[model samples]
Target: MTPSHRSDLLTDALLHYSKKVERKQITLLPQRLAKAAKVKEEARAEFTALLQSVPGTTITAVRGWGEDLVNSLEKTSISLSWEEAYVENLHQLELGRTQLEAPRGGAQVLEVVKRTERARRQVDILERRHRVRQRWSLTTTDSERYLTAAMEKRAQAVLDSVSNLAFERKFMCGLMAKYAEGQTIAKKLSRQIHKLNSKIRRNVKLYNLKRPVIPSSSTLPTLMTFEIAMNPESGLWSQHSVSHDAAFQLKQRLFVLLSLHDRASEEMNIIKRPVCRVRED
Candidate 1:
């Protein structure tokens, strides 16, 4: 065989082998691209599910959840103001009584009588204004005694309600703080995950790499994983349990208080009934 013929045959063989390899690669290209796309889509769907599962995602929702509690707390605060005013009124009433009863200097009998009458009138005015004549008067009617007792009961109810509300308000405040902290953590985690996903997608598209490589810790910022946040050993879960227990305890206390209030109300109603009189012939 001639040297030129042998050279031509070898060249043809090499060219055929290269063409076969290229054809094989072309045939597999679509499947590889489809697999990569499926993986990316799965990652995106997982992240979306995670974000949806997180509670209190919107500020409006958070605010709305606490709105009723806030209103109750505000209403309960009025009891404190009312109590202070009642105390001040009592002090003023006492001061007026002292002034009315104070001894006057030596004077004529007519002058002494006029001063005593004036003091009696002033005391009467104060008694009417303060509406405590029933409580302060030495001679009290049965009806007046009943009214005084009712007022005292009502005042006690107000104080109890205020105390319960104060405790609930404090618990709510702590719960809200925990919620806010969780929300912040959730937002930060979401941002980090999104950034990581974006980085992977960009790297894959730009380099046409078969597998996306995660940068070393030294090169990239560290991310907190969902697994860590949800782990039972973490502080987040422990705090959740603590809050849940506290809420349960508070609920029990409220139930007990409500039952007691109901019982007290029923007793008051019984007390308010007219007494029955039996005649002995």
Candidate 2:
């Protein structure tokens, strides 16, 4: 949808929900503390809800994504240690406009407000730092799941197949090279050996399969292998959430299989073939 269309829909939804639109471009969120990142967001929402439950209190999240907070605030403000920033934002509240609005016994009430705000900002600083790759503490939770022994077995099966195929390719290629080398050595010995060298070359050309690079996610293997001209399709070769690096690792096993076959053939030549074997037909 166009941005204008999306804006209209959002405006309608907010209005339908009895939400007031804020005039300020910059918004500050009340601070939150929670264990997981998901829980952090939930805690921030809960904090805001708790504030809103009071008749006169208001709490809000910062405008836009987490980066928006970093962008709206001055660099020096963010650069301060979390404790320092909390203390500073609180100081601003106590000494700034909020303090002037305070009635009798406002200083005591203001202190409470300041403490909450300061605590909240500490959480925000940690969240903001994590949002940017400024530091990389966050991680994906894909691997942590309920035991799926059956799925694991299937994955192993596919992996084994892929491994065998990969080994076969590499082994065959090496074997072809060896045979070509032997043919070259043999052709130097006799004119009759020239045909054997030619035969090996033909076999090498026919047997060496160049597997096309298809995306792990591509439904049709041939689609990604073909390059597009201008404005190449992006995400075409991107990894499918389903298909993974395991498949690629499996694909490499073909090489070893080919190598084993060549080894067997070499042994047959060394032990099975007799030196006196000559035929006149």
Whole-model alpha-carbon lDDT for candidate 1: 0.42
Once superposed on the true structure, which residue ranges of model 2 sit more than 4 Å away at CA? 1-147, 181-281
Please provide, for model 1 over 1-281, each residue's C-alpha lDDT reduced to its tens digit, 9 standing for 90 to 100. Answer: 89999999999999999878656655454445455455445544543454355453443443343454445435343232332333333433544455546665555444655645664555455556767544343233543343333334333333333233334433444334544545876566555545544443443233222112222322221232333322334443343233224444433333333334445445444433321111110
Deviating ranges (above 4 Å) for candidate 1: 1-65, 76-138, 142-147, 150-154, 161-281
For 176-262, candidate 2 gives per-residue lDDT tens digits of 554455586434433433343343344323222211222233232232121220111224223222332434322222222333344
Each model's TM-score, in the order given? 0.22, 0.17
Worst 10 residues of 2 by lDDT: 25-34
Best-fitting candidate, scored by lDDT = 1
Worst 10 residues of 1 by lDDT: 272-281
